[model samples]
Target: MRVGNWIKLSHLSAGFIAVLVGYTSSVAIIFQAAHAAGATDAELNSWMWALGIGMGISCIGLSLRYRSPVLTAWSTPGAALLATSLSGLTMEQATGVFLFSSLLITLSGVTGWFQNLMQHMPRHIAGAMLAGILLRFSMDLFLAMQTQWLLAGLMFLTFLLARIWLPRYTVPLALVAGIACAASLGLIQADGLAWFPATPRFMKPEFSWSALVGVGVPLFIVTMTSQNVPGLAVLRANGYQIPATPLISWTGALGVVLAPFGGFAFNLAAITAAICMSPDADPDPRQRYKASIWAGVFYLLTGIFGATVVGLFAAFPVELIAAIAGIALLGTLGNSLALALSDEHGREAALVTFVCTASGMSLLGIGSAFWGLVFGMSVHLMLRRSIR
Candidate 1:
């Protein structure tokens, strides 16, 4: 427990950015999903509580066991799907679907379905999808400049200068610059800020074929295809050899344990995981897991503070959030795109995947990530057949 040995400023900075980016990007969608399922203010607090606790425990526990950064998150795409599909379902029915989805995820891990699925996925295609998923955030870094030119422009310059001068501290420096700029502009909102603890509110489960088919099944599919698949790809792309089954199992079990309190679908994290796994988190790859452990500590604090934590993050201007996230992910995005198109044969297919995923199209309730994989694989198979 020597502070000097385990603690690094870079690791702490990475962990903080990971949580900050995660909340700023899609927490609104999560709030929408909870409300769609008839969640009250208290229930919404419980949902945040469950999700934060689950992520914190799994990130710390799994990373320590495997000695690698194994970050986990509630399925963002799954939450988006629920926001649309859970419109008419009662809270009890929604809880049932949550439980059912967790069961499927648990089985996927326990039975090695996740590993089997990953085994068949091409590395190039995975990289393509990862790049595609991240491209928008990269664009956002510049897009933020359109509205808040002063704030974002300063951040972009700060990021470039930090990369040149400080390297490992690039993101942290840019974040500080963005926040300082935001505050100077009077963009930070502090209304209704108060301390409060997260309290769990349970809903009794109710099952029906309608809820199962309409909600549970689609949630399972989206969580796996959109979140877990890309998540595993992030791990593989980073040269981690941790077993996928155990990681999946642990996340699924945690999801199930917290479902009654509104933990919907838990799975491996991709973008945030990239932040922790990147070299900016630590100089030595072996030490990067400590970044995830720190992220866990932040998540635990968020859970303990409940709605106050949400409000705290929400207080930051959107442009600042976008600027910081774009800066944080630049390294991982560059590496993914480079590796994806490196092979001559896979180049075209990977491009197709990248374009499709970056397009952010949704059809039939499935997100762009899944469709990107489909398009990429199809093009790859066709190219191989033509060559033969």
Candidate 2:
């Protein structure tokens, strides 16, 4: 198909918003992670470069191959883990940990172990898990209104009106409204913004037993449970049945190649992926892959101009980003809840999943998503036997 035939204004907007939201959300944690390992300014830029390039290639390649919106992101939880754990380790040893964790991910994907495990997850459970994961972002819409009442309120009103009249462009219209309000109120800060291209700085890996055991093992666990699990659930909840094996395999492979350049871990994205898969991206689900493709294009630009892109995103007000992300994901959050509660047999279990996931509970370094699934599935099985 011709590019003009598949791409639309809505697709471009969705793509841009996905990249914007991804970067603005947890980028600070990434900086902390870099600093924890004693990285210099050049090495920090290389980290962003490697992660952007890795996510860009994987998203574009996988989405085109499957004709679905396949979004990838750096491991936020992994970065958080490193931020606290990497203080004692050298950058070289940290690189070794990244490589080790990535190898485990690659083995899981190549052996089809992770995909097979996810296949056993029920549809309702998956929907509930997805809804739970996105609940915070959706709620941030109103929370943002509290701080930047005028800006967020105008964006919310615009979204509602656009949804009725311009269904496909609701998100973009809301975003524009928010930006205009922010600009008028002097919320947008453009100071210190300049074009700075990123250059890759490679570090040699030096393996150690302590780093591998303490950091590598935990990184792999969180990347799988906290990141990849909900990411796959987002795809499945939205009725995209693309195989998980290739998605996992390719991301893992890219992580291995880019780890030396400060790409700690790569995994499928949940929140940003939902933006690309939402109906507002395209009325036709089949063509929604174009959103992810455009996101990949933006990701490439972000990598090429790492510092510039970082400063650009930093210029937007936090409230604007929160409101826009919430408005864009409203449809997806609603659909996930509907699917989760549609079946009377699974309604209670699904609700359990949603509640647990939304609680944001974390234990033993594993996120609430995994625990929610486990608890929900257990309740489901027990309820089934009792009914029988």
Candidate 3:
């Protein structure tokens, strides 16, 4: 495909929103995790570099190869786990743990364990989990309205108007309207903006059983359950039929390669990927891969800029970010909820999944998304048995 033919404004908007939401949502957790591991400013920059570049490379390569919107992301839940569990470990030890966890992930993919698990996942249940995961952002839109009413209201109204008038241009219009509104309100800050380029700094790994079992194992589990599973669910729910094993394997392998440079963990993205996969991204599903490619280009720039990207994103007001995310994902959220409740037999179980996952409750160091799936599937099985 010619570059000129493939590129579209809608595709570019999808990619921009994916990066914006991805960065604003959970980047603080990544910062916290780095701090816990005693990472210096340079090391933190390295982490961003590794993650952004890894995602960029994987996303571009996979999407081009498969002609599908295959986006990769750093594991947010894993980073959250690391923030709490990595207090005692040196940066070197933390790097070692990342390597260990990635090895396990690679092994799972290579052996087809991850792919098999995804294959058995029922569609309604997957849709419910996705809806649950995204509920917080949707809620954020309203919560921002409480504090920044004008900003939120305008963005929301813009989204509504665009949906009615332009249809395919809804998210882009909303995003532009929100930013313009924020600028008018003087909500964008320039306090931390700088021109420092990102440089990768490598730390030598120091392996230990304690670090391996405590940090590495939990990271692997969380990344698999909370990140990769939901990611695949988002893809499948959105009508993509891409293979799972290769995606998982490549993510893990890339994670291993970049671990020494402070890349903690990598997996498929759920929420941001949904943006690229949604109808609002592009009316034609065949052209959605262009959005993924654009996202990769943005990721590559973000990686090259590293810490500067964080500050630049931070400059955008929280309300604007939340509003844009909620608006961008509205179409996706609606579709997920609709599909999740479409099957009469699965409706109740899907509802349970949606409620639990949306509750954001974490137990036994695992996120609500995982528990929701388990509970929903159990209920689904019980209902089938009762009917029999």
Candidate 4:
């Protein structure tokens, strides 16, 4: 097929929105994580470069290979873990911890243990978990309206109208509306934007049992459970049958190679992947990979100009990002809910998972997604006999 035949305005919009939401949401945590490691300014830029390049390559290559929308992201939860846990460790030791965690992730994939575990995951449970994971973003749409009513409200109204009149372009149109409203309201700020390319800085690794056990192990666990699990669920929930093994293995491998340059962790993306997988990205699911390809292109651009891109994204008001992200995800959120509740037998268990995950409760440094699945599966198994 010709490139023009597959590419659409909606795909580009979805790609841009996915990157925008991914960066704006958790980038501050990355900064905090860097600070915890006592990283210099240049090292922080290198971290962004490594993460951006890793994600870009993974996303583009995997999507093309699998003919599916495969998105990857830096491990936000892992960054959060590092932010608090990296205090005593020097930068070299921290790099070692990252490598150790990534090695574990690679092993999990290479051994097929992670794939086997996910292969048995019930569809309803996966759908519920995905819905639970995205609940916060959708809720933020209305929340943004409370703070910037005119801006967010206009974007939402545009979304509703576009869905009725031009269904495929709904998200793109809503995003444009948000940007226009923000600009009119004097909310767009680009006062001190700098344009500089990012350069990678590699640090030598220094391993220790304490750092590995305390930091590395937890990062591996969190990245796998919190990020990759939900990411696979997002794919399965959206009807993609791409195998998990390669996806996990490739991300882990990339993480290991890039760790010295501040690529702390790389895993499948949950929320952003949904944006690419949704119908709003492309009416035909087979062509949705184009959306992710565009996302990868944007990721490359972000990596090439790391600090500049961050500042550019910062220029947009928070309400605009929140509104557009929520609007774009509306279709995905609705569909996930439908799938989660479609089966009468698993409805209760799925509902349990949805609520638990949506509650956003984390325990023992692990995220709610893991706990939610545990509670959901337990309820599912217990109720299985009764439903029969």
Candidate 5:
């Protein structure tokens, strides 16, 4: 490859770490959710297959077609929702709920109603909502240092040096250094490496009314209201000019078809997806779509090596993962915080938004993500007629 092309490939390679971090740091809840729903090992692997393929197709196809950094991810909070709500559900019943909710998502996307509502929302409130969502995860980075100082410190330094010196591959390079330190110190084990390809398992869907009520409806609501809305906001906030409705439709439709086989849910990614979309990763915004493509490729590779890599990531102490993810998000959180505080007229309302979201309250079984949006929007409308 030529020098420029090699640079492109390396940039693409950096995106793999983003995919890995996104999956490992918080997404493990999905597996637990599957287990809670009575999924077997085969069923779990099937879920990985479905989610990987669904995300890969959406990330690759949509990004290429639109020439923007459109990425899809399994909803983390939705997975968390499943982990709690799927406790007594059967696999087939969970699948039924997945399908039902996916249809609702697709309909919402097709109607374009959600986008309209979000568009009318104040920019400050939107920024506040974004900050609130990322606040805990970002704060955890330094907090992680409190527990695993040696591991997190080295990774932190590696990231700092890379950012100051290399500038292009800070997070990925930091991961390399962190892993080396972790392995040598016996803090993490990557001893026996198996690279067997994962086989896809097919699940035949069966519906149950109780599972649909308990699992499906909430999953759909959380994924759409929390994940998809915020993911699109990340794009729009950064001035990515893509049609939200189409992307939403694509994500929902993919989930519907893939859910029965273990694809629990799919939506736009906000935190990790921002990494692929940002100018920091790639200088030219037009070329940033390649990052999402790279993320998709890595997502496929992850599914291929499914359990082995998952073990590798898991071997690293929780604080190590927490520190890495937290530090990685610091820049994003700072920017979001700044945006939240920027609007003078909206500052008070934004504070209300931030406070409500930061409080992390959930009403009607929905998570804080949805409530943050609601409270923030409510405060904004009451504080100023401009939002109303």
Candidate 6:
């Protein structure tokens, strides 16, 4: 595609906002992971750098290559896994683990193992997993009201009114309105807001076979099966058909560069990326790649004001975050749930997948995401084979 036929700056701005909203709203939990790992401010910025650089390259490169919306973000579930699992490991040790994990995921993508697994996923089950992923965020909308009534209520109302009247601008406009209300209401925190830009610190790579297996292996599995697989599915379902090899390689290279800077690992986003890539984002699909690009630009901004930006994100009330996110995801969640249960032949297995994932059950340290897919696919295949 010629540069003239491609999106203009205006469309790029819109696309960036779509990604910024999608990525930031969901990644608040990343702070928890950083804190749990005892990361210093520099390391935190490194985390941002790793994540931002990775995401920025992927957004610009992937969208340019696929000519579709290919917004990638850090794996939220993997972040959650780290928040729980990073306690005992040193930052350097964790870095070692991060590097090892990323290499494995890169290999999976290159060897087509990851792609092969995704090809086996039934449409219905994929849909169910998508729905299951969004289910928590959707529920967060209402839950946020209990803590910050006025702030969340206003945002919720803004979302509802815009959704009813002008669906396209609901999220962007509501986000602006929420910031205004927050600033006026004294909800914005200026304390400890730093001067000067972030300085990223680098750590040399170290290796430990024990840490590799204990932490690295789990990280790779969680990032791949739970994050990237479904992330690609989002792109495919939306009709973008970029080959998978380059996407994986790029993500891995980004990981390698950022690992020393407290970037645990980066992977394809499933739920959050869906938010930026959805039809609800804008009526024009060709234009949607702009969202990922815009998201990348914002991510770059995030890298600059790494410290203060976290505070800015903190300003929005939980209710507003949840409401905006949930409202944004309405179309995606609905679509996934519909597909998950729609196939009679795959119904039983898909239902198992949805129920198990939704149940939030974990066994032997494996997430429900992996097991849910496993359970669903097992039943799906069994049912298929029996029919033959």
State the lDDT at 243 in candidate 2. Answer: 82
Q: Mind giving the per-residue lDDT tens digits that candidate 3 earns over 217-249?
A: 657766886688889988888788888888889
**What's the lDDT for all of these models?**
0.81, 0.83, 0.81, 0.82, 0.72, 0.70
Give one digit per residue, the lDDT tens place, for model 6 in 1-388: 6875445555555556555555545455576567767877667766766676667777778777776778777766566556555665678877887888888777777787776765765778776755665677677767877777677678778877988998756766766677777778887766656545556779777776656665576567657766777788887888778787878777876787778886677777665567666665557888777677667777666666665655555555555556666666666668777877888888898888878766766666545655677788888888999999
- Total clashes for model 6: 4
Q: In candidate 1, where is summed lDDT lowest over 10 consecutive residues?
A: 360-369
lDDT for model 5: 0.72
Q: Residue 249 CA error for candidate 3 (Å)?
A: 1.8
TM-score preference between candidates 3 and 5, better one: 5
Question: How does candidate 3 score on lDDT?
Answer: 0.81
For candidate 2, write residues 259-335 as lDDT tens digits.
99988999999988999999889999998999999999999888888766656656888888778767765776787
* Candidate with best TM-score: 6
Clashes of each: 0, 0, 0, 0, 0, 4
Model 5 spans > 4 angstroms off:
1-47, 63-105, 191-193, 199-244, 260-296, 385-388
> Which portions of model 6 miss their true places by more than 4 Å?
1-12, 32-42, 59-72, 75-101, 201-242, 264-298, 315-331, 385-388
What's the TM-score of every candidate structure? 0.70, 0.66, 0.68, 0.66, 0.70, 0.72
Where does candidate 5 clash, by residue pair? none
**What TM-score number comes out for model 1?**
0.70
**CA shift at 34, candidate 2, in angstroms?**
9.9
lDDT of 1 by residue, 90-189 (tens): 8988999899999989998899776676576677887777677667667788899999999999988988998788865676677778888888889999
Clashing residue pairs, candidate 2? none
Per-residue lDDT of model 4, residues 36-82, tens digit only: 89988788888888988988898899999999999999987677567
